[model samples]
Target: MAFDYKNSPTDKTFMEFDRIAAEMGDIRLVSKKELIFIPSMLQEGEQVLAFTCGVMKGKRWLVTLTDMRIIFLNKGFIFGLKQIVVDLNNVNAASGETTMFSGRISFQDGAIIHTLESVWLKTVLPFSNKLRDVIELRRGMKEEKKTFSVEGDDFVSKIERLASLTEKGFLTPEEFEMQKAKLLRE
Candidate 1:
């Protein structure tokens, strides 16, 4: 049940994975001490160590994102880092007070570190820990003085702000879904 992002996954395309897996499937992956994947500097089947984020008590991960796709024990890859503007609405015409949903994925150590972020109601939020991690890691490296940004890709840097709003229950599920859907359309 892979998502057909090229054509946009329909509601059914997005929801069927769970049902199919629940009937007869098992999630599986592997872990290592330190995996290293240097883009364009290595061949396939090459990675030192890696781990799945959440699995059996944090001690093991049966599967994890390696390359741009989910990987298991034996497969391997070599890939370039890319940031795609998928799911955009009015991107060619965006000005202000626009809602957006987008992701910036990095290729490192044989994995795609996905930073899923969205914006709505003048607030931006990142809904994934990986995105938060990316923000923190980047923050530590640069001197972006604002809590969130109001510039290029600034919406993505505002995960904490969005999370705070979400915790305060400011955004309704419908709002979230609508904004998310709109972003995807862009």
Candidate 2:
């Protein structure tokens, strides 16, 4: 079944999420509720991608995904909050699993091994997919940048070598131009 954010049983929680989203001008609220505890934990420039509320190890917990990190907020009955932030760069990989009545998020250094009611799974599962995609995309971009830098350095060295060869009369100016064009194309 499709998850309708507007009509979820957690409508009140969504209201709180909306308030926080308004205050944070650039952020898009992927999902939110009292269970997620996002407003209090989110950092500046971190965009919420997905979140869910549930219980883990007998303690109430809020699991959240943001552009830069994955966070777990353990809710206490009184006074304090325990927060765990996993930067996206440190996450080697992430995966999600769901049964009829619960969901799990497995990632580097930690996992959200809790079960949400089946009604909530529709929303949570898709969020998990989106989070994984974002993480993979960031990793791919970093790899591409590294490859491009290496190629750029190689191109510069080749040009220098071609210039030296021309000066030494090992290559004519026409040959140098042709080699330069070939390098640029590659």
Candidate 3:
């Protein structure tokens, strides 16, 4: 059968809902901030709509801020904006892994800055628009310094942690043995 466009599981869901000034949108006139809540019908899954602006002319490109990632759907691909800077790590979940979502260009003191680490940001922006300067800033605005002093564990600590996981049967025998040997060498 020929592919039925409607029936097939498609991959197009995110949209920037900034129909403000046209839809009674809340506008922060002093700082040019604007907000409009998206209905559940727009996105059926777990998502967020974070705000980011594309500056060039007098246009607004609102960004969606969700728990996992930021989605940008730009209409004016060219002659609109070349680069985008998104806030990274603005996701407001209690304790979720960073493996889920990406693509976020947040406002910074300079341009939309990107980091070498954020994998998710890279994944989302390229697909939405072909801008190269798009940066995935993990929670740019409110980045909290890690309270834990430890950055990485020493060999002994690695082994001890491994031992604990192994004892709990979290690791297979081969994995345990490899880790054990590595620990001993250290």
Candidate with top lDDT is: 2
Per-prediction TM-score: 0.17, 0.62, 0.26
Clashing pairs in 2: none
Error of 2 at 72 (Å): 1.2
Model 1 quality (TM-score):
0.17
Q: Score each candidate by Cα lDDT.
A: 0.30, 0.64, 0.37
* Ranked candidates, highest TM-score first: 2, 3, 1
Task: For candidate 2, report its TM-score.
Answer: 0.62
- Sum up the clashes in candidate 1: 12
- Location of the lowest summed lDDT over 10 successive residues in candidate 3: 21-30
Q: What's the true lDDT of residue 126 in model 3? A: 34
- Cα lDDT tens digits, model 2, 71-115, are 777656655778777788777766667777655656654353333
Estimate the Cα RMSD of every predicted model relative to the unseen true structure: 22.5, 8.2, 15.5
Candidate 3 wrong stretches, greater than 4 Å:
1-46, 49-57, 76-106, 109-186
Better of 2 and 3 by lDDT: 2
lDDT of 3 by residue, 1-186 (tens): 222223223322111223222122223311222222223212345333333333323444444444344443333434342223233343222111133443333233334332222224332343223222222333432233332224234555787788789889999879989978876765
Q: Provide the global lDDT of candidate 1 against the true structure.
A: 0.30
